[model samples]
Target chain A: MCGIVGLFLKKPELRPQLGAHLQTMLVGMTDRGPDSAGIAVYHRPVEANQCKLTTFHANPDYPWRKLGGQLAEALNAEVDVEIKANHAVITVGAAEGSARAWITRSHPEVRIMGYGQLMEVYKDMGLPADVARRYSLEGMEGSHAIGHTRMATESAVTTEHSHPFTAAPDMCLVHNGSLSNHNNLRKWLRRRGLEFETDNDSEVAARYFAYRLGEGATLAEALEAGLRDLDGFYTFTMGTRDGFAVLRDGIACKPAVLAETDDWVAMASEFRSLANLPGVEKANIWEPEPAVVYTWSLQEAA
Target chain B: MNTIDLSKTPVRELNQRLHDLTPDTNERLWRITNLKGEHALAVGLTVPIEVEIDGHVGYYCAGMNKEAKVVITGHCGVGVAENIMSGEVRVKGNASQAAAASGHGGLVVIEGDASARCGISMKGVDIVVGGSVGHMSAFMGQSGSLVVCGDAGQSLGDSIYEARLYVQGSVESLGSDCIEKEMTPHHLAKLERLLSRAGIEADPRRFRRYGSARRLYSFHVDQAEQY
Candidate 1:
C-alpha cells in the first residue's frame, strides 16, 4: 500500500508554501510507504508550447549531464536539466506549436506519463523529509500539486514506478491501492499500441485514464469510466492544471480521508496525515463512498 | 515509582522508552493524559509494565502485547490488543470490533460493551466481555474461551472450531454449524476461572456455553443448502 496526497490551493500566492505543507503531510504517512516519495507541482504557463519534464529511475550510473546536452542539441531548444541519484527533471522551450510534439518524437521510449505547460515532477527513493531536502522542494512554486509515498508491493522499487504518473498534457495521477486486473489491462493497452515503462498497476491505471482522455472525454468522465471497468481495491486521486478528482473502488479495502476548508482542499490515505492542517478540528472529515467519483475544479472554484 | 506522562511525548517515543525498561524494574506507573484518538499506544511490549491511557484511542492500542499488563481507561478503537501472545488488557470503556482477533494466547477483558466481530477468527486467546457482544462475535473462531456476561447479538458463534463460548444472557441466534451443547462440569469450572480472572463478581452457574457441533466441516448433499 502507498499514500497519496493532493492539494489545490485556492490562493495562487500559497504555491511556494505548498511544498512545505506537502512534505509535512507526507511525513505523517511515512509508515504507510517508506520506500520512495515524489511530488509534482503545476504553475501557470509562461509560454504557449514549453513543457517541464522530470524522470526518476533506479539507475545510478546514468550519464545525466551528457544526456541533457545531447537532448538540448538534438531538439535545438534551450534545456535546463537536473539529475539526482535516480531521477532527472528537464525543462524545454520549443517553438509555440511544436514543443510537446518535439519532446515526444525525441524520447519515444520514455513514457511521458504527465505533461503540462508548467508542471514539474520530482521523485526520489527515500523518506519524504530526505526527498524534500534532496530536491530542494521547499522552494517549489506552483498553483497546485500532488505527491506519492510508495511502499512497492506488486512493483519493483524504482523511481520510474513512483507516482503522480503523468498521462497527458496538464494531467497527473497518484494511486493508493492494488489493481487486480492489471495484467489483463496491460495486455489490452499494449494491443492498442500503448507502451509501458514499468509493470506497476498504477501505470496501467494512468494509461487507462489517458486513453479515455484521448477519446475526447473529460478527466471526470474518464475517472467515472474507470470506476466501472477497473476491478480491485483502490482509493486514487488525480490532478490536472485546472482541476482535481478522487475515486474509490467498489469495495473500499483501503482507506482515504478528505478534509477541506475555505482556503485549502486536502486528501490523504489516513487521517493522521491531516492532523496538523489548520482548522482540522473545525473541518469535516469524510470517507468517500465506494465507487463514487468526487471532483473539484480550482478554475471553476475561483 | 517512575511516572511517565504521555501528554507531551510522541507515541513512538513513549513505546520505545517503555520497551527499554526492564521487567524486574520497579513497577513503572505511566499516566497517558490528554489523549484524543491516538494509535498504537503501548504496543509490542514484553515487560510487565502498567500503562493507563487517559482517553479514547484510534486503533491498535496495546497490540501484540506480551507479558505486559496494560489497561485502557477509556474507549478503544478497532483491533485493540490484537494478536496478543500473553499478559492482560483490561478496558474500562467500550471496545471496537476485532478486539482480540487472531490472538494466539493471553487474556482480554472488556469492562464495557464490545462491538461486532469481537473475537472473529480467534485462535487460543481467551476473551471475557462484561457487557454484550455484537453479531458474528466469534465467526470462524478456532480455539480458546470467549465469555460474555451480557446479551449476545445475532449469530453469536458462526462457523466456529473448538472455541468455548459462555454467555450469561439471551442469545439472538446461532450461526451455521453452531449448537448449544450440554454445559459439563469442566466447562463450568473454566467459566468460573475466566470470570474471576476478568475481575467480575458474577455467578458462573448462570452462564450458558456454546461451541461447534462439527457438522458443517464435513458436508453432504443433504446439507448442501443448510448453511
Candidate 2:
C-alpha cells in the first residue's frame, strides 16, 4: 500500500508555493504509507537546451562537483549542479542520449533518479515528514509536483526501491497497489531491451511507460495502452514536464480522490490530504473512474 | 460545556478523559478543538455523551464506538465511526472510504459526500448520506439500511445480504446477487424516518431500493469459474 499525491497549479501565482502545498499534502497521507517517501518537482528549466538529470548516491557527501566538472568537460559545455541531501540535479548543455550513456558507463555507483527538461525527483527510505524536511521541500518552488509515501509490499525498503520512478525524460510514475503479472510483464519488457533497476513491480510500470514513450506514443496514448496491457489493482499518479495525470486499474480497488479548483488540480489517496488545499471546499471533488486516464496539461490553459 | 483543546493535549489523554466518564457525568457536552485530522477521537465510549469536533479528523476517528454522539465539523479520513456499536456519529464534511463500516447499531450521517465502500460489510446500522457516495458501497452488507441522497458509484450493493439500499439518484451498476427491488410503503416510511433523523432533506418517493436476490447464497458448481 502507498499514498500518492499530485498537484498541478492552474494559476502561475501559486507556483512558488507548489512544494509547500505538496509537502503538506504528502505529510497528511503519512498514515497510509509510513515506510519511505518520494517526490518529483517540476521546477523551472535552468536552460531551454539543458537536460536536467537528478542523481542519487549512497554517500551524502558524494563528489558531485567533481562529477559535474567531468561531465562538463566531456560534453565541452557548462554544467550547473546543486546537491540536496543525497541527491543532485545537474543541468548539462549536452544531448540527453549521449550524457545518459556516458553516465551509465562511467558512474556505475550513482543511480540516476530522473532526467527531464523541468523535472527533478528525490526519494529516500524514511518517513514522509523526515524526507520532506531533509530536502527542505517547503522552500522549493515549481509549477507542479507529485509525491509518494510508500509502505513496502514486495521489494526491500531501499532508496532505489522508493517511488516517483522515472522512465523517460520529464516523466515520472508513482503506484499505489501491486501487480499480479509484473513478473511476466518485466520479462516481456526486458526481452525488448528495457533496463530495470529493481525487482519492484512499480519499476516495471515506469519502464512500460518509458518503452511506450520510446516508441513514440504520447502520454495519453501510452496510458490507454497501459490500461489494456497492464493488469492488476493499481492507482497511478504520473508527472510530466508540464502537467500530471492519474489512472486507476479496471477494478480500482485502490483509493483515489481528485479535487480541482480554478487555481489548482490536486489528487491524493484520501480527502484529508486535500482538505488543506486552498479553496478545496469549493473544488470539484470526485473519484476518478476506473480504467480512465485523467490528464491535465499546461498547454491547455495557455 | 467541556472544551478539550486537542492541539494542546494528546489524543491519548483526551480519549482517556472520555473513557473515565460515566453516564452520570455532568460534563457530557464536550467540544474538541484543533482536530487537524487526527485519528481515533473519542472512540470506545460507553457513556451517552456529545462530542463536537471543531476540525477535520483522520483514520478510524470513532472506531468501535458505543452510545456516544460524535460530530466532525470538517472532512474525515478512512473508516470514520467504523464498527460503531451504538449512538450517533455525524460528519459535517466529506468522509473517506468505508465510513460506518460494520456498524451494529445507531446512526451515521454525512453532510457531504462519502468515498468508496461506505458501510461495507455492515451487520446492522442506519447510514444517511446527504451527498453522493463512491463505488462498491454497501458491499456484502448483512443488515441495516443505507440511504444515499445523491448518486452511487459503480457496483453498488454488490453481494449484499439482507441490508436494504435506497439510492435517490443514479446507480452506476449493481453488484452480484444485488438487484433493484420494489420500494414498498413500509420502506418509504422507514426511509422517511431515517432521513429525518439524519436531518437530510430528500423526497423518499424518488429513491430506488436494492437488496439481495439470493442467487449467490448457495454457490453453484457452474458459476465456480465466475467466482
Residues B1-227 of candidate 2 have per-residue lDDT tens digits of 98999769999999999999988998889999866557788888899999898876777988888988999887787789999999999998888889999999889999899988999998898999999998899999999999999999888999898999999999999998899999999999999999999998999999999999988845456776775
TM-score of chain B of each: 0.91, 0.95
List interface RMSDs for the candidates, in order: 6.0, 3.4
Candidates 1 onward: DockQ, in order: 0.06, 0.26
- As a whole number from 0 to 100, the lDDT of residue B20 in candidate 1 is 88
Query: Where in model 2 is the C-alpha error above 4 Å?
Result: A27-35, A127-130, A213-221, A250-253, A257-261, A270-292, A300-302, B218-227
- The global C-alpha lDDT for each of the candidates, from Candidate 1 onward, is 0.78, 0.89
Q: Which candidate tops TM-score? A: 2
Off by over 4 Å in 1: A11-13, A56-88, A95-113, B1-7, B10-38, B42-58, B61-227
**Estimated TM-score for each candidate:** 0.63, 0.89
List clash counts for every candidate, in order. 4, 0
